[model samples]
Target: MIKRKFFMTFIVFFFLFPLQIAAETIEEPDVSSEAAILMDAKSGQVIYGKNEFVRMNPASITKIATAIYAIENGVLSDQVVVSEQATKVEGTTVYLEPGEIVSLEKLIIGMVVNSGNDAAIAIAEHIDGSLTNFEKNFNVYLQDYIGVSSTHFENPHGLYGENHYTTAYDMARITQHAMENEIFRSIFKIQEYEWDGESWDTTIVNHHRLVLGEFPYDAEITGGKNGFVSQSGFTLVTTATKGDLDLIAVTMKTNLKNEPYAETLSLFDYGFNNFKTEVIPKGSKFTVDNEEFVAEDDLIYTVNIHDKVSNKINPSGVLSIYNGENEQIASFNLKSLSAPVTKNITDENEENWQANGFLGTMELAILGVSAIIVVLVIQKLRKRA
Candidate 1:
């Protein structure tokens, strides 16, 4: 009876312990949406996600591509002539009338800041001469530069079409690329915009809720894009910065349920609370003067991880060794640096040149070819003899 009781207790402990550990493990947030993704914009690490690769309508998030194309190709100061087709695009508008004139910059502000559909069409047509041609260009652009395999665009506004859909991973990648440009980052970060024209008078308010910092989680939203359509549902791709780490969180295909904003806040808290950068030194040697190259010491050279993480009572700190832009040119790892210098062999250093690598290979090939020629010549001489 004692052995049986002990066996039963052991079985119970084994089963119950696994359950407890599983409960304690960090589970993906229960976002109400069918599809969602969260990535670290700085590192492009997807911290948490569900159905991230499943393609679905991106709604107004399509504007991220539109905005990038405009900034790359169009002159912001140039006034664009709004065509009849652009003004007639159904859905959200900054109310641009036909023949209405607005600066390219203002159109971007309206497109991104307000999620204006008409503004998207206007910008697209302006940038590419026509929406149809613009869309083909946009698809090629995504494939070439952005590497989004599952994305296709039918309309500039992302209003609705069977062929118009994008995966969450591709959308995150698009955000990552867009955020790299200073101007694009600035436009998306804005919460409000007042276009600079009388007839096109409108105050554009951003649709991204987290950008306003209303969530109780107290995370700072550095950048984001918001999208919504009847078929696509409410969607938001937001990047929030906590300490030095930046996280990009995306939610889609839901009616704003599961408190996505709150989930984002929780994600930020988890990320900031848990992980940190561990800076390791990049170079094997640092050259101080023309004559002297020294192996790095902790006092003279150090690994500069951007942030250090600690527990609830103690927070992280920045770890930096070098300062000034030019002085810190050695910050990146050796792989990031240019290939090592290759010196040509000369009469002064023929012996040293044969040590290894390209020079050695070239010298060996030359010697082998010369020896073969000499042997052929000797064979010909023997025949003549």
Candidate 2:
């Protein structure tokens, strides 16, 4: 009877413990977005994802790429005169009038903060000469600069069209790239930018609920952009920081009005609570066998906080990191150091040049042997002569 009880207890332990362990692993939030992603802003790693690669209409979020492009390529102090085409653009506007002069800085602020399609058009025309040229160049611009594959832009402002589309994954990557630029990041996350331009005079407030702190959400929301079209549904993108963890979340085609915001919070919670960014400081060193290695730059890797993260220098000098389950997470090339390794070598390791190189010694020994052999042969020839 005791044996039977012991057997039952063992079986229960074997089954229940593994199940509990599995449950303790990362659990994704129940998000209602049609497509979404939560990405590490620093490392460009997607921490949480759903239908991320499928292309959909980006709507006015196209302004993000446009805004950054303008900041990077144009002179902010230069004054731009609005064109008639800019005034007639459909959807949202800053009510820009033809021949009204505004600094490139104010126009960018108005476009991003206000979602003013007119500002986007004026900026595009001013920089690229025409909408056709702007669209053509900006497509190349996004592909080349932002490093996105599934995004294509047909307009400067994200007006819905058959060809104007981007994936949630691509949008997140684009946002990540944009956030790296100080000029773009500054314009993107402003709370309420007061604008007193030539023709348009009003406070350009960010429409994103999270950015404005309109509700009980993250006050850490540095900035965000939102868009809606009958065709595209609610498309939202936001960036937030808590301690060392900075994250980007993109949601698309949600039925509910606040579902995207809810999903954004959930994803941020999942990321910040579960994951951590570990910085392997620049110039950190390791010894692989008898050779030394150094990290070229500060290495940033994000992993689940519960995971046991460790790095190992392989025989080939590549640094590989493993997570809690002993799964490899990331690998980077280590700059080999000419300095000898910490591990000492003995006579047994003499022939193993990899452990402690003796190439110079080998070359000297060869020369000595050849010299002796040559002298010995010369003496033999003299004796024969």
Candidate 3:
């Protein structure tokens, strides 16, 4: 009876242990944003997500793409003569008048820093010659190059068109890709700039409140873009840095402006605290079936701080990373970085065959070609003799 009780107790303990471990996990901060995501900027890994793929109005954050597109496709020094339509644009404006000329760079600054609708229209008109052409082609660029699978834009200024929608994940991805450009990166983070426009000479401040340091600059805010429309609610995409890790936080469809910012900070805090980056240095080795393979280069991935990472080398020399929960995070093919296993060759072709078996399907094709060549060479030698 004592043995039976002990066995039953053991089973109970085993079952309850997993629950206790689950309870001890770090809690994600509760925020009011209807959709949100936290991403690793380099790896494009989603660290945390809620409704990340759901499409919502992106508002002025659309300019992040427009800014990068102009920086890439338009010459900054080119002069643009403002048009009456640009002056008459309804929403935000830098107060442009017809016949006033400005550099493409100045218009980009106005559009990005001040969220000027007029400036955005001016950019679209100047770069692509018409809004319709700009919209059609830029959407293709966003899809084919930036690699956002689920986003659409009908205007450069992000005015509310029923077709203008993007996901939190897609926006984060777009922001990451945009930040890679030197010119676009320079403009996205500016806190304030003095404008000497024809009508407005006042300093137009960056609308990103955290970037302005109004919210304590606690998470090392690098840069960000925010957007709003009655239909889209409050939307924000922010980038922050900590040590070697650069992170992106995107929040959308919040009730108030500050709510998206609040959610963004919470997401950033949670990510920085709970995750640690692990690097498998270049030339690191793992063995499969007594044969050795070397890492092609440094492989970097982020994992939970307390999670145990198991590195598995399959027969094909592909390294698979498994988290503490035994979930496979990713896999990579490792190259034979060392000299042709000189020792293996010394041991005989047996070792070579053993090593080649684990190098994957392509290597098998190579072996077949080598065998055919060897047979052809032997036949030629016979003919000569």
Candidate 4:
């Protein structure tokens, strides 16, 4: 009777344990934004996403792409001739006069720090000769080089255009890519810059309130850009860091001015609380088929904080990371440290034999030709004798 009770207890415990564990999982954040995404900057993993791929107006956050593009393509020291059209652009301005000359770097600073639409126009003109050309070339660069497909910018400033739209995921990707450049990073993190424009000569402050510490949050606010138009609502792109984990959060199309910020903070809290960045250090060795492989660079990935992590290395040196449930979270190709060994054939190899058979057939044909040559030489010598 005691044994029977013990068996029943064991069954009950087994069934209930999984439920308890599932209950402990971190709750998903509740956000009011129409679209949002939280991404791990190191691994490009989407930690949390709500309609992240949906197209929406990105507002001033479009400037992040413009700034990075200008930094990469244009000479910073070159003086940009501010056009009359640039001075008359609607929305925010650095109050530039017609034919005013400003360094490309200073224009970028003003555009980013002050959300200056005029500076964006000047920078766009200087780099691509005109806004029309800038729009054409910039879209190609975003698709081919930056690897974002859904983002399309009709203009340099994020003022409302019917075709001017980007997804939260695309914005996160742009921010992630831009944050990698040291020059962009330096400019991005600036909370204030002294503007010496012809009409506006004062300290231009960043419009992102979170970046300026206007809100109370624990994470180190690295940099951010915010945008608003009646058509696009409020849009924001923010980057933050805590310990070894760096994150990019994008919130778009919020009704209120502060809603994007609130959603951003919630997303950050969820990421920081529920996940962590783990690095497989450089030179970490992996063995397959008695051949060795090593990581060429640190393989970084984000994983759930509570999950046990494991890795599987394939014969071709691809490392796949799995969580406790055996779900693959990330993968990286390792470098071969030794020459690849010719693996022995087995039942599992049969399926791939057709793919690999051509080389073996070529080797056999070469051997057969060599044998025929040797026999002909011997027969010719014998005939001569």
- lDDT of residue 378 for candidate 3: 100
Tell me the tens digit of each residue's lDDT in model 2 across 11-56. 9986746633543676899988789999998877779889999889
Give the runs in model 3 whose Cα sits over 4 Å from its true position. Answer: 1-24, 281-298, 335-385
Worst 10 residues of 3 by lDDT: 336-345
Which candidate's TM-score is highest? 4
Q: Write the per-residue lDDT of candidate 3 for residues 1-385, one digit (tens) a residue.
A: 9999999999998675664465357798786788899998876778899999999898899999899989989999999988888888778888887988999999999999999999998899999888889999899999998999899999998889899998999999898898888888788889999999787789999999988988875568888888888989888989998887789999888768688877888888888888767788988887777678888778878777756667788777888888766788877898754445345466778777767776866788899999999999999999999
RMSD values for the candidates in order, in angstroms, are: 13.0, 8.1, 11.9, 10.0
Runs of candidate 4 with Cα error greater than 4 angstroms are 1-24, 340-385
Q: Write the per-residue lDDT of candidate 4 for residues 1-385, one digit (tens) a residue.
A: 9999999999998674653465367698998899999999999999999999999999999999999999999999999888999999999999988999999999999999899999999999999999999999999999999999999999999999999999999999999999999999988889988777777779889999998999989999999999999999999999999998999999999779888888889899999988899988998998999878999999899988866678899989899998777789999998888954576678548757865797789999999999999999999999999
Candidate 4 Cα deviation (angstroms), residue 82: 0.5
| Backbone clashes (count) for model 4 | 0
Displacement of the residue 359 alpha carbon in candidate 2, Å: 22
Estimate TM-scores for all models: 0.68, 0.81, 0.79, 0.84
Q: For candidate 1, lDDT tens digit of each residue in 162-266?
A: 999998888888888888889998998998777655466666778777776565556678867778888998777888776656777777787764366666666
User: Which portions of model 2 miss their true places by more than 4 Å?
Assistant: 1-25, 197-199, 339-385
Candidate number with the higher TM-score (1 or 4): 4
| Candidate 4 lowest-lDDT run of ten | 16-25
